[model samples]
Target: MIKLPSAFRTLLGWLPALAVLVFAGMALAQSFQTQIYDPTTRKWVDYTPRAAAKFYNRHGQSPEEFRRQVVPFRTAEKPGTIIIDGDRHFLYLVQPNFQAIRYGIGVGRDGFGWAGIVKIGRMQEWPTWTPPPEMIARDPESAKWANGMPGGPDNPLGARAMYLYVGNKDSIYRIHGTNQPWTIGLNISSGCIRLNNEDVSDLYSRVEVGAKVIVLMQGAALYKGV
Candidate 1:
């Protein structure tokens, strides 16, 4: 048996409580904010998309070409576009009783799969990335937040965010902005649909909260990678 001296015993008694404090401190040490790193200009820009900010050179996009290569808008086929062949990874925005706008996208991994028709429930500029609890649970080193992350360059949501919901139910899937312009037509997200910042901005201007989004399975998926 270990005999404890009075002063020594009191100190040992505090050890358990001390350990708790240390662990608590570590958990609270995590910090997060919107950070920007402009690779081209060599200056960091705010994530917020504003009129004053030009993300890139705006070149003319021919309506015919846009309707052709971008989104075919199904000449005389479906009423709404489809994001078919997620395994192939492409998102199609359908025109009402007309053609479909086709844009390549990066989809979620195996288990995070999603499907069906949703709408652009909400849109935001320079959106923040308050990773979901499940996402943080998967990667704790991330900028963690309980509520939501603020809009900034550092945010994973990039320059814009499109919330996807069914009626009033949040499917947790989003068609949002991406800093990686190269991955515009690649496979890289969890379940969320992705688009280059430039492309997303264009889509944002065109699509509204009530606009329809069809995530389908395309037979052929091909896109140019930058």
Candidate 2:
């Protein structure tokens, strides 16, 4: 029978313990994942589920109304046109039958109702929020929002924003991600459509730079064409 030397036996005995320590260290390093920082305050914020859940609960909002504002949609429609149910808070990327990639949305708040067929003219990453001159004029405090608002977890636009445009006009209105995920099912946007940050981020990645976007107020009728 062969036997391990004493020194070799000792090293072998230590391997399992060494492996566990290495794994524990890796996990500890990965514990810090996402960050939300405010340069002005010189602070770093952690994205923890409990903190987010607590913020949602503290807001004077009904939990149901902010649940991504989505409902089942007929996605199998013909591929040429997109179906937007702003009234119902869902957008559908029509396919062929009666189904779609449905997404929850927040429509215009108070006086920001819009009805039209617009194309996605321009797209941006962490878009700068330039308060329309009109918005600044409405309230002097809004001037801070001008000169372009930087993107972050606290930014009203959340992580992503899709700017809707008509021919020569950039609709002051937008379709964007919101920090206020709790406001999802509600029509509480100034003039833009709101989406959960993750959802909007996904949508932004799927849609292209010049995708044709058709936003509708009424539920689309069954398209009866080839």
Candidate 3:
């Protein structure tokens, strides 16, 4: 039998430990890397500030909940229609071939949901927010903004807003972006539909003025042709 050299045996003995340290280092590096899917480009992009991602992932709403994907949704509405399923917290942009670009949304809280067919009467980028008289009455703190709040990152409306109107009358409801992206997929709005900043921007670009928006309430009939 051949005897191994002492030095060689010592190096071989340390190999397992070295391997573990290397693997641990690799995992630690990967832990800091985070990515999110961009539905607009249909690709994954790096998400900055890993801490925010970790917090969002841990609290509620899986990462997949924010991803916009082409889903198999059979709606009688024709292409170019927007169907908001508030109960399901999903907004479906009807597409060709019985498919839709499904977007997770933040809808009105209990006793605040609405159902109706309205048109996209107007669109605004970085729109000012004015608390209605009733809203200000309920929350006096909002009275400071009674005049109006300028649009910005801190604004309740994140990026874009599409106003809903019924036959040339403002419905006082909107499909708009939210500063609190974590609110997406949650019931926490005051009778408006909320989308992530990126999502609302995307929807705003796709949906033109005068587009039909059908908001569904509990026990509402699904869209059936026209």
* Strongest candidate by lDDT: 3
Worst 10-residue lDDT window for candidate 2 reads 217-226
In model 3, what lDDT does residue 173 have? 78
Candidate with maximal TM-score: 3
**Compared to the true structure, candidate 1 yields what TM-score?**
0.58
TM-score per prediction, in order, is 0.58, 0.61, 0.70
Best first by TM-score, ranked: 3, 2, 1
lDDT of 1 by residue, 1-226 (tens): 9888999998686675445333332332212112245677898564332211233224222112112244444444344433544654455656675555665555554334444666667888888677767668888876356577787766678788888866765555688876554443334566688766666676677666766666553321111110
Tell me the spans in candidate 1 whose CA falls farther than 4 Å from its real position.
Answer: 1-68, 71-85, 95-99, 218-226
Residue lDDT tens for model 2, 54-96: 5458854423433433334554344544556666666666544
Consecutive 10-residue window with the lowest summed lDDT within model 3: 24-33
For all candidates in order, the CA lDDT equals 0.55, 0.60, 0.75
Question: Which candidate model has the greater TM-score, 1 or 2?
Answer: 2
Model 2 Cα RMSD, 1 decimal: 23.3
Cα RMSD to the true fold for all candidates: 15.7, 23.3, 23.9
TM-score for predicted model 2 compared with the true structure: 0.61
Error of 3 at 194 (Å): 0.1
